[model samples]
Target: MFSPKSVSAALATHFGNALVSPAPSPLTDEERRMFSRLKILLTEKEQGLIESEEEDEEALVQESGDSDSDYDAEEDEKPEQRSRKPWTKELCDKMLEFYRSKDLEDGRRGASQSFKRMQNRFRAHMKTEYDLTLLRKYEKTGVIPSVRYSAMRQLASDVRAKLGEKMKKGVPIHDTDIRKIALDLNKLNAASGNFKASATWVSKWKVHHRIVSRKVTKFVTRKATKDREKVLKQIDELRIKFLAVVRKNPGIVIINADQTGQVKEMHSTRTLAEEGSKDVVVEIESKSATTHSVTVLPTIYLDGRQHPIVYVHLGEPTGSLPAKKAVYGNKNLVIGASKSHIMNREAAARYFKEVLFVQPMPKHMLLLLDSWSLFLNHSFIQGLVPKGHKVTILNIPKGGTSLAQPLDLCYNQQWKCVMRRLNDAILVHDIDFVLHTRDNLLRCISQVYWAFGAPMFKEYRKYGWYRGGFLTTHPAPFVTPPKYMFGEGSEADCPCSEPGLIRCPYCKKAHCFSCFVINSHRCA
Candidate 1:
């Protein structure tokens, strides 16, 4: 435990000459604040010392009070007899006049003009010459600085208000504008000259103040917007009319077709890395021209039916390609090739006649597609007229496929995502595997079709054709199809080996028609 002596020694060491000597007189504004705090500390610590000093003063005051109490009481009774003068309107007006005189000098409206000159003049004139106690007190009101500070603060606030207005108007505030604001603030404050208004500083300020700087992303042109609106309105009107026609026709079908490109090696969408590491390099398989791509055409019926995907590969189609005709009469998915690897008019016509037309053609069909030149020819339209099916080609708005076309918006993304995953898995598992090889490529494309099509059918059911009332049946050739079948029905029961004969439409599984009708819609 520390004795009182030790505590005193410690206090003495801390306070030093401040304890022994009196505080300096006529203190400046800052010093006066320190003096007041010191007085409080002394009052708490040295109460005994203060009582000793006040003893003589208290005795003298007591004696004087005995005689002067009655006189003082009388003076208090008449309040008007007070020595100090109260601040009258006349005195306030005089001080205002002095301030305004300087304020008006050279048209100085901003707070950058010094208020100290007027303050000093007011104090000197009132104290020495007039000898009038206008305020009747000697306390720091900080009136001049307070007024000037408010003015300076208003300048910054105005800047903020202007910035808010600009943002609301969608006018971007650049770095130069921020610098100008800072410069204005410096000018508004009489004391400060140099202010940091660097672009980095402005960025920090914006974030700290919760002022978001959002970049404007450009999308559709004005003309494109108008065209899209016009096209969509037309589609909506025609779709309603088409539904009315479909109510009478049971075999009517709504179909959407779009093409997507598949790359051999897909770049990683996301990857794992240590925090704060910058340069991350992930090595991929050896680059080849074949890694570029191949085109695929995916067709979907509103009844949630997806046709076998037609792959358009580079170079000529060879014997290595999957056979056109399976053991069954129906043709399999037509995998064709061209020099450019794109479906030309001939390929497009073949796809229409071979794969699409080979299926049971609906009585009245609506084919929703993008504005591809291959499907717009007179020959293509005339060919459909001869068939019992009335095929209507409704073109989706140009540059609006991503938004309007269900195939482009939904199936294409899902297809590519599945293909990417499969390709990545294959590359990771068997490093030597070449995806562009005939068998591997065929297998990969086939997996993309079947794997993506199953789950996709469910989504289409919920979102597409059935909801739109395009077809009466649920179109579950994949679901209701049988797993096994008797082949050419011989005495020795033989399972069907024909590819097209035993394929489920919904899930794309191998099942015969009898099993499909009996089991009916076996999902996945």
Candidate 2:
């Protein structure tokens, strides 16, 4: 409801509109855009006012016989929306074929065709395939918009010529590009086309744009996206910081630790890295039934064996930690579960104070942490640092955690796959122990991670750091998780010499389904 004077004054103050200000004769891009916006707003307001006032009253006016612009008349007067026509490779080629043939017939070299010819040829070509416009409409429907078809035909002809030149230049065309053109062309003398691009479509259509896309029918949803600039910047920053730390102290431990939420069931092979991100999407199942979760924090070193992993779940501790004594476990795991079942500030602080700081390690070390607020909070971490140790914290940039963190780079996906395989075994063999139970879940997570501390995984985990640009050379090769746990590569036999169903991660022994599941893989 702004008056013309008020709008002018606002534009003069904000956009420096030359009409209202004594700046200059010529306006800048901002001023021009503001003026254009003002014009559109004023025109829309005036038109709206007229429609509101005259909607109920119709004056007896004489017919001048000048209204043949898209004329259709019925009782309701609501014209059916036009169907969208995607320009496929074959269709585009056909259009160009007609253009070339017509050019040759006219003996015109590289000359644009006339609007009438173009319009007639396009109409005939569309009719041969399917004329969506000619479909029967409901009775009592009428075309409302008064647009000159001759003008629209001229514009379509111009667009066709422009696209033809692009085809000649060998630039690839996409349906989306054609859709944008179609939408823009329809805008002038426009008719709303039934092109539905919903948010659900965008979210589910998870293929990367460059990798290629698939369409369900004629709809073309845009491919999922990635922030390349952020990824590149994070990589560069990590490389610089890591090399600097290594140069300063050649023996500093480079550790990448990440806390991931493990679903109640591990049927889906999708890792936590791919959970929220649209990058590198693959369809997975068992993702929806996560009623309970366990937080698993794994610390992988760039050079040495990893420390015992910490498992956190959702509940208050029933017993207090003995202040003077250490918590003992044969599985070499540290377990805790706060009420939240997430890596909260208290859990982060506890991890440093117990599992990390107490581990036998060098005095100097470099730790890579994701930019979680609690991990970065000074008050939370200040008391957790050990007195004699030099812990340099490198904050992995936001959204760049996957690109920089060693656990996220590759190891975590493999870790989840192992967990999934475990779930599969339990389900297939009908194991007595319910992994859904908190204690059993903790035990399963511990056993998988404890196996990682073995000699085979020591060198295997270094590859993640190497891949993340921390290590100069690749580490020595090791067996993959699938081969080791599933006996995919080499043959393995149980004590009875029957074909082994699964391998015990801790005891380094193979067992049959009866022994693995029924006997709880008793290797201890």
Candidate 3:
């Protein structure tokens, strides 16, 4: 198969050229030390005598009379030099066992926890007998006990894989889990006098391996899901019914009412400080005495009108004070007194008679209410119903108040924020001024009404109705079962006499006692 030219070229090439030696490449000091370490390690391995990187380097440098040369140059450059140690299989197993034994009381994995006691015990055991010390770098890096990089890497990968597999199986991953695993592995391998890993090794591994921390959120409960469906269906039905009513009576008022409490405490308004100063102190009202608050019942209509704020102040009613005189000119704000500083059935009924009833209204009206016992009371319902007003007791789906209630959704928070700012201004002017005194507190609240009440209520109208939001479709009781149906029965005959007598705190239902006992534990 050979051509004549190829055969001639092969015959002309001399085979004796293969025997000629090439020039030797001289080894650098670094290369020489590395080769020397390799040689020592290999020999020691064969003889079943393990020698560490640090020990071998030291021996080689002493033998070469170049202790200060490039042999130790690498260690000198580092902030801290790593001293490798030999680890036995026994030591590695012990570390793993120790970590496995350590667990938090709540059953969370505590293997990677860097407690002082854990580190001290490890250090003591290593030094007392083995004449070895664990480096801070190794403690942070989560390096396994073995001096060999390949072995340590494999061990780390195994532990990480186990953690990943646990997570896949629905086990919650804590930030400390990885550290615990590394610490346990290190402890187990300590008997062999091997270099253990550093605490931050897992952090590096997470970044390099693309591991990310994710927030754990609670899954939607079955009851919440059912409530949502029911609420949506009810809202649609109410929209149809309400729209029809609106067509019949164009001026029929649609109002949502709820009661919230506000304490007579001041928050920060403004601070005078230099631009660069990180810390600035604005004195807030300290709890030197028991703080008292007034229950505020605010109502907003679909047509952007806010009824007078009903401030239920604690203590008996004394005639008009300076605060009452200041607000008497407006005639829009009202204050009432309650023994407990909370709105009761009497207070609510009085509010309807004095504030809501007096407000300009059409023959027909819609009253939106929550599942409060006072709102669902017999007297409250009778007073509103006989007067020919529609009552739609909105059964705010469980955990749906923020979404369903117009006041809770945005208005109250903004109102409170504004009130706090006002209170802060008052306190800044006079720190010794007491806001809990009836006159001063009422004055502050009256100011809040003047500053924020009108504008905030206007914004509430937009959020609740104009757009395709929660209020676009009315939240009627058609598809959803209401907690209490107004005018259904007399509540006075009941033993508890309160509408919330049969209410379950756990499942948030107002029903018969037998029903409450059965479903009261927790909703499915």
Candidate 4:
């Protein structure tokens, strides 16, 4: 048996050297017992280690050298013995023949899933063993030519013959017609395992010819000078009417209203002389500046008031929004901006809260506007109108705003006044701010006066007169000067001399003359 202090020191020397040594403590009863047990276990293990091998040093070295020699021999034999898979002509022919024999249930017989799987397997196997250079050479030399071409040849030729017959009958071959013909040929090839290459070539030729014909037609159809001017004038008139309506109804939102600002390039001539030339060579060069075009759409609310609702569209167009222009080019000429409807819907809600609903309420706001798709839809309008406010939407008849809206009549006058004011402001203040400020003020005043003043105030005044409401003999407080006198009687009639001759006190109607009162006494 070992002493506890000697055993602890020996254990520290063997195992605790790898770790930080703990502070020395005097052994209590439990600590003394645990240290005694650990000492016994350590002594037993140490005796076993001392009794074991220090005898096989030469044998271990000889065993490691033999293992290394065996590993080298295995490495040397691996390349020669490894199997290599090659894509031969036999594999390509077998795959092609299988597809040719198989009658696919689906119309897509040529590129069936089974056929694709086989093709993919072939490609993968080839890629693993062969270089891309070998594959390209095989494809070019027809050693492993794609069977898809041979399968499509006869059908292509048949389609070409049909198209040629149609052409001989004076039927113009359109791109769509050519595409349909090509598709038909492809389907035939899939079914019959053969298509003519000539059909593909003929279809392409027809498409090219059709495009050339269209270009020639477009060039020939250039409007005469007078007709062009007339069209331009019409466009100007439409623009003027459009602006007028927009001014009257600020609620009528037009996206991309700002014109594209592009400056024209200036061309100058320069003289050039060659060293051996008798006469100086003159070259005409014209540099045209690039002009960017922005598409502008004038939209109006079909209904004057916005509803309290919104709509979200998912997926492609159905019938909700119609195509504006005919598809003429290679790609679809989608006129409206991508996500414009979403943006416009957002703008409508913003404008309604920020501008329209900001005003004092209970007044019926009649918004006169056009019927553009963006505004005509109920979802957009619903989001615009505030709750509990009376919003009346008045949609102007299609193409009739010029004759109907007062703003149209007033635009030229307003524009002239604006231009004059701008000139005056520029001269007096030497600032452009005046023009914007004054123009905005004028437009605001004009719109307010025209829409509200004329229809509500002026019309109500006339209505009141017809209903025998209090007729003003003298200028009323609210009514402007040149006071409205609403009576059959003239100024010569005296109320005192002929009290009965005077009209009723309440409405001042001569029909109810018996109710006339002067100085708080009823007429007798």
The best candidate by lDDT is 2
Off by over 4 Å in 2: 1-227, 269-289, 315-331, 489-492, 496-499, 504-508, 513-524
Q: What is the C-alpha lDDT of each candidate?
A: 0.46, 0.53, 0.45, 0.33
Error of 4 at 73 (Å): 99
Q: Which sections of candidate 3 miss by over 4 Å?
A: 1-249, 266-292, 309-330, 384-398, 429-432, 453-460, 466-524
Output the lDDT of residue 503, model 4: 29
Q: Indicate the TM-score of model 1.
A: 0.42
Tell me the tens digit of each residue's lDDT in model 2 across 1-524: 32445446655555534463443334556656676776655554543321221111111122213222332211122324533343444655555555445455567665544445555877733432112222111111332212222233333333444433333332322332233333344444244433221222222211211112322222222121255565568769778987888898877877778888777776532221212333433222245435446677888778746776564544434433334655334355666655556666667777887778875756887888888897677556756777887788778777666557778876777787777666654443334555565556666676667666666776788877877778778888787665586653112456765445566656677666556544445454
Provide TM-scores for the models.
0.42, 0.49, 0.39, 0.21
Best by TM-score: 2
Clashing pairs in 2: 75-140, 77-142
Q: Which window of ten consecutive residues has the lowest lDDT sum in model 3? A: 54-63
Which digits, one per residue and each the tens of the lDDT, describe model 3 over residues 1-524? 32343322322232222322332234556555555555555555544344232110000001122211211111112222223445455654454455345687889775542444444655533432122222322344544443433334444555556555443333333333454454445445432123323334554545444455433232221233435556666656655665666677666677777677777674522223323445544444557423445777777777666665554444444522345344222244566665566666667777777667664545566766665776556455655553555444433333444455667765676666545533532342223456666655665455444333333235444465443243555433221111111112211122332222222222334332222222222232
The runs of at least 3 residues in candidate 4 whose Cα sits more than 4 Å from the true structure, single-residue gaps closed, are: 1-345, 411-416, 424-524
Candidate order (lDDT): 2, 1, 3, 4
Q: Model 1, stretches more than 4 Å misplaced?
A: 1-228, 231-241, 244-250, 289-292, 308-332, 384-386, 430-432, 460-524
Native-referenced Cα lDDT, model 1:
0.46
User: Cα lDDT for residue 492, model 3?
Assistant: 14
